[model samples]
Target chain A: MSLESVVAQSHVIVCCGSGGVGKTTTAAVIALHAALQGRKTVVVTIDPARRLADALGLDGLTNEPAQIPGLPEGSGEMWAMMLDTKATFDGLVRRYAADSNQTEQILENSFYRNISTSLSGTQEYMASEKLYELAIESDYDLVVVDTPPTRNALDFLEAPRRLAKFLDHRIYKVLMLPTRGIVKAVNVAAQTLLRSISKVVGTEVIADAIAFFGAFEGMEQGFKERAAEVDSLLSQPDTAFILIASPHADTMAEAQFFAARLRELKITVRALIINRMQPSFGDNHSPEDLAERYAGTPLGEQYQCLAEAQHLARGEQKHLLGLAQELAPAPVVQVPVQAFEVSNMATLQMLGQAMFDTDVTSEP
Target chain B: MDPKQFLTTSGVIIVAGKGGVGKTAVSAALAMASSSVGLRTLIVEVEGKSGLASLFNSAQFSYSEIQLVEPSLGVGEVRARTVLPEDALLDYLKDHGLKRISGRLVSTGALDVVATAVPGISDILVLGKIKQLERSREFDLIIVDAPAAGHAITFLRSASGLEDAVKVGPINSQAKDVLALLNDPTRCRVLLVTSPEETPVNELIETAYSLEDEVGVSLGPVVVNGVLPELPGLQANPLEAAAQAGVELQPSEAQNLADAALFRLQRTALQRAQLDRMAQELPLPQLLLPYVFTSELGPDGLAQLSNGLLAKIRDLPDPSRS
Candidate 1:
C-alpha cells in the first residue's frame, strides 16, 4: 500500500482535506516521488498561499506548469503550477465563446466578472476542469491535484455540476431572450415581478445579468459537456483520492466524513494520510515510573514532561487507530511531526522518506 | 488601545484565523470571558459546523439564539447561536413577502446562483443580519466566529463591496449602516487567532494587513493559541542534566527522554521565533494561550483557555482610565 503503488496504478491522484493539514505539501511530495521514480508528473495546486512553489524550489508559479529547477536529473520530469481561477475562467470563456466579440461581451459583463473570479465555488470548478483537461490532453504520465480548502470536501465534486445546472436553467435563457418578445410572451404578473426585481436589485445588475446570459447563450452546451467530462474523469477507475488529515479529533472527523462522501459519489479513496503525528517514545516506561525513577534529581520535572509527551503521543496513536478501524480496508500512512519547518528540499525529501517508510497497513 | 479596553467597549468582535487554528475555541473562550465580566454576550457562528455547540457540550444550536451559559457568579451569562447564509436569505425573502418562492428557489439551486453570482451579496446578508442584531441591543457584546482567513477578509469587506456595487437601494442603505459600524473603531473589533506555527503565523500577518488595508478594520489583538510550554534548563541539553544528576538510565529510557526533550525544546524554539517574528512584523498587542493537553476541547478545556485569555486581557492597560 505504498504511495508508489498508488501512483503507479492511478493516472489521476486527487489530494483533499481541510485547511492547514499539509495537503499541498503531501501532494507535492507525492508528485516529486513519482517523478523521481521515472513517471512524468505534474502537481496542480489551488493554494493561494503559494506553498507549492516554495516546496518545489521555484520563485513562483502561474497557471502554466513550470519545470521544477532543483531536482537532481532524473528519468522522469516534475512540473508544478498554481491554479489561477480567474485566468482559467477567462480561458474557458475564450474557448467556448462563438467569436471574439462574444467573448469580450461575456468577459466585460459585471456579473460574469464577479462570479467567474471571486465566487466561492468557481475556483473548485475551474480546478476540476483544468485537472480533467490535463488528464485527457496533457502528456504527463501522472496528474496530482490539490483541491480547495472548502469546509466540505464534496464541494469540489459538486461545483462543476452546480455551475452547469445554473447555466442550463431556463431562467437565464428566459431573462436573456429579446426584451420585447419575452415581455409579450410572458404573463403580466411575471413581467411585473421581473420589473420589481430589477428595481430592487438595480437595473444595472439586471442588465449585466441579461447581457452575460445572452453572451453565454450558445456556450451552455460546451460548459455542460466539459462538466460531465470532469465528473467522469473523477469517478473513473484511473483516478484515486487521497484523504489527508491530522491526528486532531476535528480533522479526523472531517476526513472520515469526506471518505464516506467520496464513497457515496462512487469515487474510490485509495489511501488516508495522517500527517503531523507525534512520534511515540515507546511504551517501556510510564510517566509515573519515570517520575519515581528520577525523584530528587534536577531532571525530575523534565522526565515528568517527557512522560507527558509520551502519554500525549500514545493518546494520538489511539485516536488514529480508531480512525483506521473506521476506515478499514483503506490503507493509512502516518507522517511524524518534524522538528523543523518544511521550507526546503531537504525537509521535503526527508518527509517523503518518512511518509512511506512505514507499511501502510500496519498500525502507526 | 489596550486589549482589555477594546474588549470592554466594542459591541461586536469577530474572531478569524486559518482553519484548524482553534478560531472557534478562541471565539468561545472570548465569549466566556466577556460574559464573566457582566456583559450579556452572544456568540455567533456562520459555518453551521456546530463547533460552538460541541465546545459548549450542548445538544445543538439552530438559527435562533439559545442560552448557552446562564448568568452565574463565576461563569456569568452567555448565549450562543448559528447563522446560516441560506437561512438568512430565507429570512430576507420572508421580510420582503417573497417567502413562498424561497423554498422553490433553494430547491432548484437558483438561490445559490443569485447569492454567489453577485459579489459580496451573501456576505453582506450575513453581516447585515449581524448588524440588525447589534442594533437591537439584545446583547451587550456580540462575538462572531467568522470563516477562515481568506474568506474572512471577503466577509468583512462585504459592506464596502456592496456599497460600491449598489448605489441607491435598501441594500445600499444597509451596507452603509454596516460600513459605519465596521469603520467605527469603538463599535467593532477584529481579533486574529493563530497557532504558534510557521504557516499559521505567516497567514496571520498577511490577513492582518489585508484586514486593515482592504476592509479598513483595525485589528484588536492577535491570539496565539496552543503554544507549548518550555521546560526550564532543557534548552541546551537534557542528557547532560541527567548525567550531572548521576542517574543511571537504561538505553531505551534515555533515548525516549532525549527524544521527548528534543521535541519540546525544538517546538519551543520554533514558537518563540514565530511569535517574535509576528511581534516584529505586526507591532500589535498579542496574547498567548497555552496548549491544552486534553484530547478533546470540551467545556473544561474551554474554561481553562478562557481563564488564560481573561488573565491576559486583565494584564492590558485600561486606556479609558488613563
Candidate 2:
C-alpha cells in the first residue's frame, strides 16, 4: 500500500480532489518521487493555478512534455506538461481531418472555433484525450494526471463516453447531412426547413454550425474509436485513482462523494491522501495539563495557544479517522501542514519523503 | 463606501475566491450581518454543493428560497437557496409555455447539448435566475457563493459572452440586462475572499484584476479569512523565554511547546507578508477574520464571524449616504 509500490504498479495515476487542496503539488511530488526511484514519469496537470511549473522548477509549461533538468544522475527522467484544451482539440482536428482543406474549413468555422475550446466539459475531454495519447504513444513508464477540482473531476472521468455520445447522437448527424450530399434527394424540403431555422437562429450561426458538422462528418468514427480507447484505458487494471483532500469537513465530504462516484464508475480508488493535516503533538504532556502547569505565568498565553493548536489537531484527527472508517480498505496517507509552501524541487523532495514516511493504513 | 453600506446598497454581492478558501463561510456571515441590520437577505449557492445548508445546520435546500435566519430589529429576513442551471432551464422553458417539452428535453439529452454547445450558457442561466430574483425585489440583498476563482471570472462574464454570440434574441436581450446590472456599481459589487496563504492570495489578486478588466464589475473590500493572531510580547523563541524564566520542563513538553510556538510564529509571519502583498498590490480595503479554533463552523460559529465582520465594517469610514 506504500506510494512507491503504487507508483511502480500502476501505469496511470489520476490525482483528484476538490479545489485548493494541494492536488497539483501532490501530483508533482508523486511524479518526482517516481522519477527519483528510476521510473520514467510525466505529470500532466489541468490545474489553472500554474503551481505545477513552480513545483517542477520550470519557467512555464506548455502542451508538450518538457523534460525537467537537475535530477540526480541515476534518477529516471521526469517530464511535465500542462493541458491546453484548445490546442489539444485543434490537434485532434488536424489528426482526424480528411485533408488540410477540411482542417482549414473546420478550424475556420465559428461554432467549432468557439465550442472546441470553451465547451463546458471540453477541458476534461481534452485531458482524457491527451492522457490516452501519452499512454499509447509516449515512452514514459508512469503518467500522473492532476485533474480539475471536484465535480469537474467526475466530468474528466466521464469525458470519453460523453464525447462518444455527442458524436454518435442522431440529431447532429441529421443536421450535417444536408450539407454532405447524403440528403440531396430531399434537398428542397430540407433547404426550406433550414431557412426557417436559420431565420430563428441567425443565418450565419446556422451556416457555421452546418460547416462545422459537415467538416466533422467522416471524422466522427475516428473520434468515437479514440474515445472508446481512452475509456478502456482508464478502466483497465493498470490505472489507479487517488483521492486527495484536507481534513476540513467540507473537503472530506467532497472527497467521500467523489470516491463514491468513482466506485460507481467502476474505477478503483487506490489511495486516499489527506494533506495539510494538523501537526500531531504525540503522547507528550496533555495540553490541559500544560495549561494548568503554566497558569498565571507569562508563558501562560503561549500555553493557551498551544492548547488551542492541540485541540485543532485533535479535531483534524477525528475527521481523518472518520474518513478512514468511511473509506475502509483504502490506504490513507496523512501529510502535515508544512511551514512553507511547496514551491520548488527541494521542498517537493522533503514533502515526497514526508509522504513516503506517513503511509499508514487504518485498521480494518 | 464602508462594508455595511456597500452590502445594503448593492442588490447582488458575489463572494468569490479559490476553493476551500471559506467563501461559503464568508457569504453566510455577510448574509447574517445584513439580516441583523434589518436588510432582507438571500444567500444563494449555485455550485450545487449544498454548503450553505451545512453552514446553517440544515439538512438540504431546494431551489426555492427558505428562511434561514430571521431578521433582527424588524428590518427583514434572511433566506438561503440553491440554484442549478438545469433547474433554471426548466423554469425558463416553463415560463415560455414549453413546460411539457422541458422534461422531454432533459430526458433526450438535448438540454445537455444546448448547455454545452453554447459557451457559458449554464452560467448565464444561473445568473439569469439571480437577476430575476433581484428584479422581484423580494430581498434587499442577494449574496452569491460564486464558483472558484478561475471559473468565477467566466461565470461573471457569461452575460457578455452570450450577448456577443447572439446579437439579437430574447436570450441576448436578457444577457444585456444582466450585463447592465453587473456593471452598475450601485447595483452589484464583488468581494474577493482569500485565506492568508500564497496560492489563495495570488489567485485573489489575479481574479480581482480580471473582475475589473474583463467583467467591468466594481470591486469591494477583500476579506482575508483564517488569519493568525499575533501573540504580543512573545520572544522569537519560546524555549529561550522559558529558559530565561528559569522554568523546568521535561524534554517532550518543552519540545511540544516550542514546536507549537514556532509553528504559530511562522504562520503569523507568513500571514503578515501575504497581507502586506495584498495591500501593496491590490490597493483595495481589506478585512481580516481570525482563525477560529472550532472543530465545526455551525450556525453559532457563523454568527460569531458575522459579529467580527460587523465590527470591522463599523471601524471603516462611514459612508456619506443616508
Pick by lDDT: which candidate is best? 1
What is the C-alpha local distance difference test score of each model? 0.80, 0.79
Model 2 spans with C-alpha error above 4 angstroms: A174-203, A283-297, A360-364, B1-4, B71-75, B93-97, B233-248
lDDT of 1 by residue, B98-126 (tens): 66566655665656556655667767888
Native-to-model Cα distance after best TM-score fit, residue A71 in candidate 1, in Å:
1.0
* Model 1 vs. true fold: TM: 0.94
Candidate 1: which stretches are off by over 4 Å?
Answer: A176-192, A288-297, A359-364, B1-6, B108-110, B236-247, B320-322
Clashing pairs in 1: none
DockQ of each: 0.51, 0.43
For candidate 2, lDDT tens digit of each residue in B1-322?
A: 3555757768999999988888989998898888877788898888876477889877677887788776656556888888887887667656655554556557656555455556676788788889888999888899998987788998999898889988886668778988988999888899999999988999899999988999999988899988877875244355665665567667777677777777878888888999998899999989888788765687777888888888888776666853
- Candidate 2 lDDT, A178-262, residue by residue in tens: 6677856554544454454444335666666656666777888888888888889998888988889987877888778788888
The A-chain TM-scores of all the candidates are: 0.92, 0.89
Ten contiguous residues minimizing lDDT sum, candidate 1 chain B: B1-10
Candidate 2 — which pairs collide?
A: B38-B75
